[model samples]
Target: MVFVALLGTGTAVAGQVRGPAVVPLPPQPALPQLPWLPPLPPVPSISVQALPPFDVEPLDLDLESIGDSAQEAVLQSLQALGTLRESASVSVLGSLQDGFAFRFSQQQPPRDRTEARAEALYRSARESIDRGRYENAIQELDRLIDLPGTSRVDAALYWKSYTQAKLGQRAEALTTLADLEKRFANSRWLKDAKALEVEIRQASGQAVSPDSQNDEELKLLALRGLIQSDPDRAVPMIERLLDGNSSVKVQENALFVLSQSQSARALEIIAKTARGAVNPDVQLRAIRYLGAIGGPENRQVLDEVYRGSNDAALKRAILRAFMTGGDRARLLALAKSETSPELRAQAIQQLGVLHATTELADLYRNESSAEMKKRVLQAMLVGGDADRLIELAKSEKDVELRRAAIQNLGLMAAGRTGEALKQLYSSDASADIRREVINALFVQQNAGVLVDAARAEKDPAMKKEIVAKLSLLRSKEASDYLLELLK
Candidate 1:
């Protein structure tokens, strides 16, 4: 049976499918009527080339397919995915295929017939090992490793060690694994090799670390074993690895193993490392892992980091960490109080990304800086605050701020957005703002409104501009309306 690896560890119990989430609409206040365009001044003939390019590059609509190298069982599973009615199952299947495709693409291709034969032999050896024919597997793997043209000697070496260990050749197996490690440093089998080596050492009553040597890889191997069998014992070793002695790669791996542990001591060590690691990369890694293993405590630590660190980069990282942790209260507080206006704007934008509409609108209401208020308008758009945007369009006193509101409203194709634009067009006396409203209607591709407006318009310049905008639309209805205007 094919099993899809889920993103999280928790088992999903099938639950009842629910309807779409209902967003509660905010109350819109009454809008005032604006003056219509005044009587026509003489229209200067405008060239159509002055308009912006209308044709955009369309996105690829082709469906992605499974790679040809997929195993038969995997291919069958993908084929059956279309019949699944549940969204959950479809999501799981999609992730599985994506993961499989990535791994399949990473596999090295055989160079020639010699390499192909070596791979076949290697597969046969793996089959032998699975069937408990250790001697035969070892013989086959050794032969493959000795072949001059074999591209998969790393795999052959790994399986040889595995089969040797199966036959109780611990010392020989360890030697073979060392050879594999030294020769194939970039091999994908390195992690499994390290794991198997550690297992063999433990089973043979050999110490994980000998008294004389400081082998970093061996220690890392031992650390991995302890994390699984006894995470309490693993914490100190992990802390040691994080202490500027180990390479960044080893330290990051240590952080990954530490994150996997469920022990309170493990979490405490992670928090401590996140706070105190002098290495910025290590510190960043710990912070990200803390975000992944989120809780109130982790959120508090990030909040403290944001308050204490003067490093803009570190503060930015903390902002993202808080975003990941879903600490909206902290984010809102930062958005309000951050001394740096740029970071304050970033925090407000993150709040929008998190869909904190009420808080964002509140910020917009009190925001004193013109530039910062524009950012707030952008945040409202990101948060899908259509009603709030309409309200801002109607109520904003600053002309530029109101323009910003109307501009973002154009991004929405909703009928309400079009209606808000029409209302603004009728109420505001500024021709420039009315032109903006017409541009917004163009953005919504509302040709019918443009036709009606064009028909009723007395200002020849405004009418010409409306027709020019209408010329951008390619729909049959838009074409028919333009023909009628010409007639």
Candidate 2:
């Protein structure tokens, strides 16, 4: 066998014998076939699922019905809380449970006839007195005094005595005063009655007793009464009191009498004491007198004292005196040129009371001191200078000054308040400024605008601030927005 073993083991043509006949590899097991999955449909750029149509049901609500229901509910709740009381059904006992309620009760008994007559007569007497009808006043006083069970009988008697004295009925006036003293010893008009008695006796050329002079209360009472009826006689005594012979109380009382008198002599004495009294107490009372008796003469005296005295406190008093006298020109001059900051500030405030808006604005524009500028802002607010305040809110450069202006703007009812606050909030990045803006908006009771601003805000801290402000609002819209935020 020619080794032709059928190209057996190794092929003879290739090489002698291959290392070994290559053993055929066994067939691999086939993989299980996966079910075909369609390619995921190309994702649409927009939602593929059909969206619900944009629609809103128009509200055809009956406002009347809703209002009625709301009102009914409120009434029911009030009833439950005991806030709804049937006034017509309230008995006296029930009304008295709330003691003050009895005063307003409609079931109150009608006024007694005698009491009504007394009140009518009293009113007539007052009107007659006001009209200088002393005879008519005396007639009404007599009728009122005779009305039985009238509480104003003593009051009527007192006025009758006054009317009698005014008519020069000395004996009749003395008799009336004596009856008032004997019958109504605890009357509120007792002191006045006694004073009138002393006045009657003095006018009648009767020797006044030491009891009237020794009793200080009686003395002051007598002096006040005499000043009203006999100013000529009272003037000398007033001068004596101002001369420091009497107690401080007596001097003060004398100053009061002078304040009421129209006598030029009295005014001269008052001005003298106010100008240069050794006793500061007397000077102070005299200064107050000039302020109370405000006129050109008093103003002149106040001005003189203000210029000559080195007392800062007294200078302040002069400013007040000018205020009381309505001396706007003097106040304007003081506010402009006074060296004392306190006095200047005080004058500015008085000018505000006088509504010196133009002068106040001028001072605000020209003022340099921060404290003084603060005072100007206050004065402008008091004077209702809204335009000036708005101007300051926009143009002021000092931070504190601006803040003060803005704060005062909150106090005012300026037409530009909302606009000014919005502008400040948008332009000023300061947290404090923004806070003030929010507070001002809150104070103005602006809910809708505030809510819109809050919704549009982007800054986290500022947005938080806006929400904080809105949270304080009582509006339904604000409440709804807050509920949404809670989610």
Candidate 3:
């Protein structure tokens, strides 16, 4: 007798379908199965062979097999990933046979290789010049000039000419200068090129007369050269130009040339011109030159002009000259004794420029006018005398003057002024003074201190003012303090 059984779906195991487990039924009493089972004609000796386990792996679709639509979808997904990650790694290849030809690479901008190379060569040339390697620099510059469309061509030509001149190749340098002039008519480098041409001509013993040049700038260059080569001759010509109806620029250049001379004649001419021997403008220039020359004699010359002159503008020029000459004693004398308020104020300002804090403090003590004292305070501030300013803020009896000192203190460096302001704020009970202190701290952006003051402050009005200031600030401390207030 045979028994038949039905099978249900099987389990998958390691890429192979497995048959379900079979169970044997308990042996039935013999009769019923034999009659019907003759049909189960001998489930004859059946033989089964288990097949080899099938191998499995992830599918790799060929690029050729991927459709255009599918490719676009994949590329878009990669682009989205790149955007989310803020990266440039995403790329799409056209085909496997094309061997990693990226479509995205075509969108990338090409680098300015020519510009980069030109810049490198130009820099190398400059470095070589600094090291006194003229020949090497010339080689690099030549290479740079050969590059097409280089913006530095004009600069290269100028430096090359300069290098050629340094090497005593005067004829070659002139040729290069001529080429630069022809190629770039409106180039800014032409000015320096002309100056260099004058220098080279002078070095070669060629004459360069100031009168020959039409351009004032070129004439100035020529005059400078003449001064160096023949000062006696140059001095007479300069004197003629100054005394003649030459342009003011020409006269100034002449004065500058004369100032460079150490001869007694030059000094006499400068002194004579300084004492109003010329127009007011030239007189002012002369005064400045004397001050710039700055010696016992020069100072004497300035003093002579100051004592002899009544023009307020002339006196002010003298005062500035004193500052330029670093003659603090002269400035102090004027600040103390000058009766003209405008002149006195000018003197005080000059002293401040000299940072003569001691002299300023003394002037403040002797000053009877509140206005003059206020000027003294301003001068002290300009001199960066924070210690004096702090003293004035603390002890000054005049409210306006005290407030002025506090405001100036705010303009100073915070490290020194911040603590001083905090101390003043705590000690002073006057709301106006405290408000000035708060404004000073605000200018310093000392939000941490403002927050502390707000918490400790009893007046609702002042607290609200501090909070309002904090609202305009973007600092983390201000924001955090505001958040705490919200809580």
Q: How well does each candidate superpose onto the true structure, as a TM-score? A: 0.54, 0.53, 0.55
Angstrom error of the Cα, residue 149, model 3: value is 56
Candidate 1 lDDT, tens digit per residue, 247-319? 3345656777788788988888788877853445557778887876889998888778777777554676677
Q: Candidate 3 — which residues are off by over 4 angstroms?
A: 1-219
- Any runs in candidate 1 off by more than 4 Å, and if so which? 1-229
lDDT (10s digit) by residue, model 2, range 1-487: 0100111023356556658678899999999999999663222121101111101111112223344334223222222212112122223212222121101111112343344345456756865864668999998888778777677788788778877876789999989988988998876567657767776777689886553323544555677778879989988877875673443334566677677778888888889889864345457668866876788878888988888887664676577667666788889888888897656767887776556788887787787777777777766655566678778877788877777777666545424466777777777778776766665565554666677778877888778767766765578978888888889
lDDT per residue as tens, model 3, 1-487: 0111111236677877788988988999766554444331111110001100000111122223455445334333322322222222111110110121112211111223354455557667766865668999999899989988766688789889988987899999999999999998977567667877887887798775554323444555666778777888777877777775543335666788788877778888999899875655568789988987888898988998999987665786788788778888988998888988757866886676567889999999888987677668766655667899999999999887788778666656667677899899888999988987776666556778888888889999989877876765568999999999999
Candidate 2 segments whose C-alpha is farther than 4 A from its true place: 1-214, 414-419, 426-432, 443-449, 472-480
Candidate 3 residue 448 Cα shift, in angstroms, is 2.8
Worst 10 residues of 1 by lDDT: 53-62
Reference-based lDDT, each prediction: 0.65, 0.63, 0.67
lDDT against true structure, model 1: 0.65
On a 0 to 1 TM-score scale, where does candidate 3 land against the true structure? 0.55
Q: What's the true lDDT of residue 23 in model 3?
A: 98
